[model samples]
Target: MPDLLVGLVVLVGAVVQGAAGYGMNLVAVPLVALIDPRFLPVPLLLIASAHGLLALVREYGDTDWSGVGWAMLGRVPGTALGVLAVATLAERPFSVVVGAAVLACVVLSVLSWRPRPTRGPLLVAGVASGAFSTAASIGGPPIALLYQHSPGPTIRATLAATFGLGTLLSLAGLGVGGQVHLTHFVFAAWLLPFLLAGFLLSGPARRFLDGGRMRVAVLTISGASALALLVRAAVG
Candidate 1:
């Protein structure tokens, strides 16, 4: 891809990541996929690793470390399993399964079907999110569900920390598998300026969002992406 186009993608992605702790994948992967779909998993993980570290720093003192730790317990094994799945599975089938799961969340939400408000349910969601995120780099839906029970900053902090660790694992795995290259790191390095700028702009916006409204918006975006994936999967 041309440098200008790549810059454009990075810019948009940075903004999305700025506004939401998790948009690096949501914003960049689709556009990058259009250019070279197989590159999706690698760049998404790298960009996510960058944003994850940024979030950890910005939200440091305010983070709920206990929650982050608990989520990681499930995430570690979940991610390992997810990465294995990605290694073994075909892209189209995997995308379809994830798409369908996301669509189910959308449908349930629209119908006013509340997520089961039990600890067991939340744990299950956490595990699912970890696995899917590790595999597809699109793990926001499960996290979105979990965050509905939290305030905005807490939600952002927890997600940033959890995804930060997950993305770290992903990058390491990709490196071991020879899926990521120095060129990709260079690309990501060049894009860091926009990522920082986005985070700066997002700080104030994030502070102003009503806690309840932010939770709802996060779920809605996740749901919309799932719907798009469903269409892509079905048609393709």
Candidate 2:
């Protein structure tokens, strides 16, 4: 029953991410944190990596390789910083920070702050993504914000490539810190089918998100999910 609930969450998160380019973590993190904090960080990262891989396979040709390169450069250091923080601080505080970060990005985008996926912004977003993704398993918002104005395919493909590589780096960092365990992979395996289901569901959702609807969905889903994280953190 618990796994069923978690699977459902992963399913929905995948669909959101599949259509809007990002939101899997935003939707999955807080609720999973409530269900089993132990399943977090590692399991979600694994699941997210899979989701990114699926998106990449679907839209491999549309990625912004130059932006991905810059983002990766920043992700190296940002991931290290995140590893250090996760090693030292409690997870709840990081959750609050990620929640706030998502909300802040959403607000800026909503207010017509158009950030392009150029070198400077990609680097900055990559850093934020690495740190947040490593610490809270919710790194998509920073990178997603920059690509929010892009065509749906570009947003999906680029973020997918970036996230797939970035997540591997984070997992390696956590492994070195002795935070990752064999069991986490098993837990992620349990959620894998539902994650795939969500991605499949997202195929049709992409149509629904066309004609600038993807941008609105991105902002709305990200903002609402951030609020949920904030509330969950505040209550506990």
Candidate 1 lDDT by residue in tens digits, 1-236: 55546556766766655555566666676677776554456655676677778877877776777766666677777777787787899766887899788778767776686664245654666677777886665777776665665667667777788778867876787788788877777767766776677677777667666434676667767876677666666777
Best by lDDT: 2
* Cα lDDT, model 1, residue 202: 75
TM-score of each: 0.85, 0.89
* lDDT of candidate 2 over 65-183, digit per residue (tens): 89889999988988887878878988778779889878988998888788888899889988988887777666777887888788889888898989899988878877887989999
Q: After superposition, which runs of candidate 2 have C-alpha atoms over 4 Å from their true positions?
A: 87-98
Cα deviation at 88, candidate 1, in Å, is 3.9
* Model 2 residue 79 distance off true place after TM-score fit, in angstroms: 1.5
Cα RMSD to native, each candidate? 2.7, 2.1
- Tell me model 1's lDDT, rounded to 2 decimals: 0.69
TM-score of 1: 0.85
